[model samples]
Target: MASTEAIAAAFRIDPQILEKWLEGKQPVLAKYASAHQQIFAQFEYIGGEWHPKLDRQSSVAMLDEPSQSQNAVESDRVQHPNSSEVDLEPQSTAMFQAVGIVTGAVHLDWETHKHSAIINGSTYPLFYISQKRKAFEALKAEVAATGNSRQRLIVYPRVIHFPNKQRAHEIAFQLVGFDKGQQTKQEVSRELLDFEFKLAGLWQFIPVCRIPCISIFRNFSSERLDYIKQAEPAKKVKFLKASHLPLLWKDAPCKPFRFNPKAEGDQGHPTFVTLKVKFLPERNVFSFVEQLTPVQETAPPFLKASKKDKASLRRQ
Candidate 1:
């Protein structure tokens, strides 16, 4: 499954934006109705729990030639198909849907039986106050009108993200309050309400993002990375590129990693190649292993031909 890092990489946003949303204190992570639908459009639900679909590329590579690979599979079957371990990379840990998440100050509402925050002239319900009531009251008390700064709510999810449209979901969130004078702000992109802007010490939003950076959730998912069955390699030797140095995966920041070699050639070990076979749980870790230098454009060799050559061509 895609991680927050993968999604961020795919959409070309910052990974930390989704990292803040990982621990959902509420049942449903909400998002903007329109943006949620847009995310769903990216993956077709295979069936059952409706796990997001995996395109063929992010798909695990299959070995076609080796009948003996079945022997490798049989050995690996001893290991459980799934793991209880959380991924080291935050993005790979879960699939989150973050869209049009508006950051604002929390104003808990007893009437609505939930907290509500106002943004862009719209009041959206913020869930999780019941569990974090103590923190909620602390926030309310911390910023009481005349303070140096106001409390901030790092709301996650948009209007559209939900289990289903028929049953609307509660938006998950976290409460962050800081001393305005001491606070320093930085972000990849987010929708900050006017007051939040002042709190962030931002005069104007820079790199205004129109699209929401959603997290790819993988809870209770029966899905597993496509099983890779490799027999023990007989040798450890491999080839290396002189210029490329230590063969690299063609990775773009926030893009799917393109490992150099597809898979092990046989029971033999791959040299000078990091087998591209495994679908890593964390995109941020492996994908950012190397930063590729930009390709500098040089005048075409053909164009650099001497005037004598040009005259020769014209005569021909």
Candidate 2:
């Protein structure tokens, strides 16, 4: 079957129009004629609404609730809070925090066209898949121990990939809060700015520094490696000769994953390495003394100061 983009381009119409027709847009039949009707009907029968283009409001509503029961009977059914595209794994009540992965694919020029042509051709198409799996794995263990299935844990993963490097940097900074959080009255602001510039695209920057850690899952299957090798004309991709890759932690020491590279390559699909690296917020212990942090009081303002006292002060 021709890809959605290819089919849409052939019809000289927006892919969204084709999508609308597939979503029971009977009015489109009169506009496009019978041939297009057959095409749309086939799409509905095979693809169904599995690939339905949801509007912003519907998308937001779908994500608002976390503990919605999913109908497991239907294979192509939509689940609230956790769709096939984005999965919200169950986490512990104590560790019940929202985690988001801002993933971007840095593609080679020729491979870019190949991916655009094929629906699932991109290497990082399942970019958020592994991250979601890790979050679920961590949370499931905790939930199993405590027997707290009622607790809601939300994990949102967003994939962003564009050619512009500067825009990518902006996205990285925005996700990490390096741009916004660096605005405090301190001498270390310049150092933070420099760090943001260096680790823009290569590093996946997480917003919440304390709760969740950014983990990198790398698959070295022969097919994937071949795809990478063929995709890159310059041949910049390199394999680690060591069995285990080094793990670097923020504000902590480095610990490496143990594996013999030579032994792993004996198998059909060579090696697979996943590194879970934690990025903690760099805190200057001395700076806490320098800056007088604002105290957040939950009590009403008038409770601390009476209304009559305020009235007397206003009269004066």
Candidate 3:
């Protein structure tokens, strides 16, 4: 059989919707199609001051690969810039508190833009990936250079979900902060989707400061991701083979399954990775302080005396 992507591309259908159809779960594919359309539109071209793109691996070819096992990698314990990119405005004071690596197999999820930043004699603002899917086929097999050998060893694959209408609405309200009915909503929705997709492209490849316990689940399919979301009310899960949803709180992180690029035939399916998750501090957004001062009574003495007399009279 043709790969799911190939088949979907041939028919001009979203690959995610096609995955469910292949699985014989065909009732509500329309909802997913709606979301996929809105989200995919913004990914075409993210013109920005700084963008993340793939740079060649910095490591000079060694006769033998580094003898770094999983344990050694952990013991070395490098903190990645540990990214979950947010286009922060002049918000409050915040610093990406716990800076380190996001463990498990990482995927460069979005396109990267380059700006001139140099650190330790190396270029700053390097390449990475993030939020949503890019063009149909190009995103899946793209290479991410994380100078870290640990991240390099893992598989990379296409793992993303379209922004649901609710997500779009939230982005519209929070980022755009205006609601002129449907038109503005749609515009903001596109903006949010584009922002995320652009972030995914950059962050996925760019290194971070914190080492998070996030593992990419191999061999998972979009259909399976939907099914996993259908847990009972107690679990508050409702995704699984239904549709793709964002990974909300890293604190209460959801282990959505994803395919590993290098994993063989069955590796494209999804499964949960058991990570020892530890909450990290907020990303630093500059610093802050506050000041207060006493105010003298500006009221006339007659008024003050009248108020006092009124209080005394009431007491009597």
Work out the TM-score per prediction. 0.27, 0.19, 0.18
- lDDT by residue for model 2 (206-240), tens: 22121112222222233333333332221111111
Misplaced by over 4 Å in model 2 are: 1-213, 216-247, 252-316
Mind giving the per-residue lDDT tens digits that candidate 3 earns over 225-270? 3322342321111111111112223332223233244555543212
CA RMSD of all predictions:
23.5, 25.8, 25.1
Instruction: List the candidates ranked by TM-score, beginning with the highest.
Output: 1, 2, 3
lDDT of 1 at 232: 11
| Candidate 3, residue 16: how far the Cα is off, in Å | 8.4
Using lDDT as the measure, the top candidate is 1
lDDT of 1 by residue, 28-96 (tens): 235433433444555432222122333322111121111342321111111111222222222222121
- lDDT score for candidate 2 against the true structure: 0.25
lDDT of 3 at 84: 15
| Model 3 worst lDDT run, 10 consecutive residues | 167-176
Q: What TM-score does candidate 1 get on C-alpha atoms?
A: 0.27
Model 3, residue 189: distance off in Å is 14
Residue pairs in candidate 2 whose N, alpha carbon or C atoms collide under 3 angstroms: 243-261
lDDT of 3 at 263: 50
Q: After superposition, how far is residue 71 of candidate 3 from its true place, in Å?
A: 8.0
